[model samples]
Target: MQITASTVSLTVDDVAASQRFFTTHLGYVEQAAAEGFASLARSDAALDVVLLARGTEVLPADQRDRHASGLILAFTATGIEAEEERLRAEGVEITMPLREEPWGERLFQVTDPNGVIVQFVEWVTPSAPANA
Candidate 1:
């Protein structure tokens, strides 16, 4: 199957908060919106983001009441340090300070108003293992 686009649908308690965070900080534009739903798009990628109000009828019966939890929406980014600084200057709290792992992944995180965790990551060349 050929996929032309992708989207992550999140059930949230406050659609407006998620909508504001995406559009204001993440460079997403609204494709569509209604009382309890929003479709967001970005020019740089095919990944779209959809926000649905928790308990809204638009979701399946079994999923309607569930809010997004234990999920970290991550974006692979360049110049992560600069991005982190820019976000900090914009008053966005850094839930996880920028740090690097032994495997060569640099990342940081921020939590949106509704408690959704968004992370930015950058990969660097890993050092050769001692036993390699």
Candidate 2:
């Protein structure tokens, strides 16, 4: 089947807080919103985001109170260093400092007001070993 688009739904304690964070810091635009729900999208190819407040009735009985945890919403990005710097200049707390792995993965992380972890990554050619 062809998937036309993608979205990630997150249940958070404060939907508005998460909403503001995504829109203000991540460039997402609000598509729709209600008392406890919000749909956000970006003009680019990035996946959409749906924020649902904890205990929202639309969720199943067992899942209503469950908040998003142990998840990191990662996006492949470019100019990661400048992005990190821009975020820093905007007063965003960088939870994970930018670092490059030996395999050529460069990444950093930030946590929104609702404690949602967002990460941006860039890839480049790995540096050759000094001995090689």
Candidate 3:
């Protein structure tokens, strides 16, 4: 099957809080919203986001009360250093400081008002071995 797009649905205690955080800080615009639900999107290829209030009936009974946790919604981006600095300058708390891994992945994270972890990542060329 050909997939046209992607979206991440997160269940939070306060949908409005997460909605404001995403739209205000993450460059997402509201596609639609209701009393306890909101759909957010960006012009870029970034995945769409849907925030749902906990215990919303749209979800099945078994999963209705489960809040989003234990997942880091990571987005691959460019110029992450500058992005991090810009976020800092805008008063966004840096939950995870920017750091580079030996395998060439550089990443940092910020926690939303509802405690969702959003990470931005970039990749660089790995260093050659000294013996090379």
Clashes of each: 0, 0, 0
Q: How does each model score on lDDT?
A: 0.93, 0.96, 0.95
Indicate the worst ten consecutive residues by lDDT in candidate 1. Answer: 43-52
lDDT of 3 by residue, 1-132 (tens): 999999999999999999988988899999999988999999999999999999999999998999999999999999999999999998999999999987899999999999999999999997777788
Better by TM-score, candidate 3 or 1: 3
lDDT order of candidates, best first? 2, 3, 1
Model 3 clash count equals 0
- By TM-score, the best candidate is 2
Candidate 3 deviant stretches above 4 angstroms: 129-132
Error of 3 at 50 (Å): 0.4
- Minimum summed lDDT over a 10-residue window in model 3 is located at 123-132
Tens digits of lDDT, candidate 2, 65-132: 98898999999999999999999999999999999999999999999999999999999999898899
User: What's the CA error at residue 65 for candidate 2, in Å?
Assistant: 1.2
For model 1, how does the per-residue alpha-carbon lDDT over 27-119 read when each residue is reduced to its tens digit? 999999999999999999646999999999867899999989999999998999999999999999999999999899999999988889999
- How do the predictions measure up, each by TM-score? 0.94, 0.98, 0.96
Per-residue lDDT value at 12 in model 2: 100
Query: Which structure among the candidates has the greatest lDDT?
Result: 2
- Tell me which residue pairs clash in candidate 2: none
Prediction 3 global C-alpha lDDT: 0.95
